[model samples]
Target chain A: MSDRIRIVVLLFPAMLIIVVLFFGGLVVGLMRSFNYMPVIGLTEPNLQAYWSVFTDQEFFLSFLLTFHIAFTSTVISSVLAIGAALLLRRRFVGRALVNFLFQLNLTVPHLVGAIGILYLFSQSGSFARLAAEWGMIAGPADFPELIFDPYAIGIIIQYVWKEIPFIGLIVLANMQSIGEDYESVARSLGATRWQAFRYVLLPLLLPGVLSASVMVFAFTFGAYEIPALLGANFPAALPVLAYRKYTDVDLAARPEAMAMAIVIALLSAVMIVIYLRYSRRRIRD
Target chain B: MTHVSIQSLTKTYPGSSEPSLDNLSLEIASGELAALLGPSGCGKTTTMKMIAGLLEPTSGDVTFDGRSVLRDKPEHRGVVMVFQNYLLFPYMSVAENVGFGLKMRKVNKVEIDNRVNDMLALVKLPGLGKRKPSELSGGQQQRVALARALIVQPKVLLLDEPLSNLDAHLRFEMRDLIRSLQQEMGITTLFVTHDQEEAVVLADKVALILDGRMKQYDSPDVFYKRPVDKATARFFGGQNFLNGNATNGQFKTSFGVLDLPIDCRRGTGTLTFRPENICVTGKTTETNTINAQLVEKIYLGTQTRLKLAVGTEFIHAVVNPAEVENLEQGQRVNIAIPPESLWVLTS
Candidate 1:
């Protein structure tokens, strides 16, 4: 056999596996959402599952709640990560140690950090115990319920802790690529330090910021572990709601879970594509 | 227009054993284009950055037109710099990039437009306003950088190897462009370049530096003809160096003895001469000529370079293309060193 043919033959299995596992599953789920799955004994095509997904009150609330958490956490993390990356741009004593500590999140699972956050912020946790010991509060009962709050503050905090370092790593890589010449040139061109950063450095960093924010938002939207562990049960996020629907005793609820998964995937893909187009236009202009 | 004066400026980088610039003092008059010509690591860029206030001097001060700008910021000093890479903002359009400094100064809109248009025309990039830097070629980007700096009408213009990034042909064209622009604007310009030929072509006066020290500061002609030290002589295209005794306007060497002018009466010293100053002739004689065999010859388009073995040393001499008819490899020839062209450097 020729080398090109041999190479194609060697790649066939992996390609087939990816198509079967990813695209094939996606097509099957999408067809099932339209109620045209012969394997499940629903032959006539219909929009009943999608209509249920759209009209369900809890579905809309879960979608809005996911957006709120992801957008808020992504924006907050991007700003903090940019600040941290700028601070770490210059060499100082213990810089390596500080950088390692910031990147420690990538090694530790998010669920582990969420557990630690719960312990620290819970009503009967270390913070409450410390408050009682310091006489700032009378007892654990006086300590406010920070974890499992309806607003998902604990989840947002945990997400920021995990995501900011990831964004910082990206921002720092881009900043290092920019080097010191641009800043020095701006300074020589009669720009102050802050003005130089605002004019020259920030514009150059927009691409990295855009892509990193997209990744952070997508990860936060689909994140199941931290929100499942720390989020309030009253109004669950889409991921949590989907998990509940899948585990429920009713076999009919599984379609709605699959439909929710498809919606989340589509939303993330659209957001990424739109962000990429916007950033490309900005860079071109 | 502004006159720039430096008083013992010194810059010592952190953890470095030696200062990059050590107690250097120089002055550039208003509307004068001065070239800081040096080898790499000679503190040329450091000096330019210090003058632009991008770097703080370890000690001493810089003054512009009788005003000490040591404490003032770079914007307040009214100094602008054109970097080696041009550093044109990649995201902004050419017009926006050129007008950035003016906008920062809050110039009126109509006046900013007129000035930006005039600058673009001056750089010969009139209609390229809507294009980004990546869309422009290297030379065009350099022109935009030049326009960006000059549009503000800065008091002093600092250029750090602005033409080095260009190709040889573009470098020549941009050199001419920079010279004409500087002449038209009459702004005090300080250009830093390691290319000796570039320094001679674009500068009214050249400052030669080596190892963070100034070697010579003079007109290009004088710097080439009369160098004070061996380093300066070797830097300005003078190739041949001979160590011999000089006494009473005469010197004796292994090649032959040649008569020197009355001005160079040092007892013993080194003599330097350019390759172009040495001539080879078919006619051989005992006086004022050294009999040497041609080892190799290289044909450059306009001139043929001949390498001759004189004593134990090889000396390069340039001859006219037509003169090659009388010269061949392994031929014995008499090489003549004119007395006036010999430069004697003592110590």
Candidate 2:
């Protein structure tokens, strides 16, 4: 009994955080989403907010936009990550510096990464000035609009830039542990370099690549800050739309905002379930 | 004619001054299965890797059929190595593993399948081709690796301790299997082993290497009967050594003097012989006889190992069990070291 008491006491802080910030907040959000705001005299339990959000063409477009942004960024990041990991697996001069450059952004907040993307790709950013100096364009106005565009190109660049090294680290670790013996054996047996890589290293590297890709996809699917900062005003990402509606001045708009937040949470939950299933198929001995 | 010539081969790993293989040179004849015998850290595997192009040498060239292959890519170099661990691709089925090289060569699917089946049958794993490498037994996995390498018809086949992982019965079985397979295929093979018996029995010629240098290269009979040096003599089971001074044809030792049957320089030398070669008898009258007191006798059916004490030296002799059956422990016996049986090792 005392041992159980000790464990419970040790876990009390973490459990309190989970209950108050996670589940307790989730319950409040759910109640508000169902039109149960007693303070505003709307106490009847109903699914009107869900129906409104589902029928709203803007909401539907934002949801699709969110999916498109996450999916595109994830696919691009996975390809770049696999290529970088394969290249870095070999010993080369300045590899340490390259690895350090990748890790430098890893721990920085996503907001910071989004700001970096905006600075590099904004109309009046350094790239435009350099292009102007080179006489490639007339002025900063002639620079292409990459950030805050309807295509969400800036949001994608931010997410992909941050996630590539994250996924590459996981894959490089797996490939290094697998060693180069199998490739050497293949070469000894008259396999050309590309043939050896395709028939041997690719099969061995697939499981690691796929598992890391799942993590990358799940993370980008629910990411809020980068999309909120870089996405356009109209077809905002799901998280950005929910956050914008939550901060609106109208008191009655909170319920719809709660509904969108609930939808985002549910979609993230589904992604986590799928990710767990894929993770269980991890490489076996 | 030499099929594989490793001329002045040396490999010094980066940041190391001492070479792993120091200017080593050896020639392997066409269709000859040669065993590269050495103790651990003797650069046998290094030499083999240099030939396979898996590892580049610091200085030297390896040629197949008088053509230099040092600059060739490993895929172009028609050399294959069956590594120590039998590295069968874990994700591939046995048949797929065997067919990989053929697939790389752009062989037709039908031809690849046919050759894979035939190769599986050749390695005695015919019907088990669909099983993954992890599912096969150690011996079966080894065969799969062998078949995978052999299906490509490499110009030089390198076998690196292929039977080391097997149990005793399987070791002997695979030993015979490998020998017969090599003979049937007529592949010029380089077999690396630390096992002296495996080196002697498995190869048409044995090259005994020590400290990354070749000590002796000769037939197995020469290795056993007339080893070139002390290392080869000891490695090839030279159990008895009588250090003495040689004057003319006679070697004078503390125990007794024995006549050297072969021509020897009149100086200090060592007489080397196997225990079984020295005959222990009750009567002795002539050359190469040692009169010693029988100290101990171990009766191992068909042969009795006798530990004889002469003056201050002990000589081990293996005689017929029947001859030593009735001998007492302190009986005087004469051990005849026949001149032909003794190898006068000068160094």
Best by TM-score: 1
For candidate 2, give the docking quality class from DockQ. medium
What's the CA RMSD of model 2 in angstroms? 3.7
Supply candidate 1's per-residue lDDT for A7.
Answer: 98
What is candidate 1's lDDT per residue for A14-37, written digit by digit as tens?
999999999999988887677776
Off by more than 4 A, model 1: A36-42, A273-285, B252-257, B280-296, B308-315, B329-335
Q: Residue-wise lDDT of candidate 1 within B1-347, one digit each (tens)? A: 88888788889987787999877778888999999999888899999888877788999789998788988887777888899889998888999889888877778989888888989999999999999899999999999999999988888998999889999999988999999999999999999999999999999888888888888888898786789888998888777788888877778666767788667757678887778877776565533567888999999899989889988878888878787766779988888877877778885
Chain A (alone) TM-scores for all candidate structures: 0.91, 0.87
Q: Local error of candidate 2 at A168, Å?
A: 2.7
Residue B124 C-alpha lDDT in model 1: 95
How many Å off is the CA of B178 in candidate 2?
Answer: 1.5
Model 2's DockQ score: 0.77
Q: Residue-wise lDDT of candidate 2 within A35-58, one digit each (tens)?
A: 999999989979998988899898
For model 2 chain A, the run of ten residues with the poorest summed lDDT = A276-285
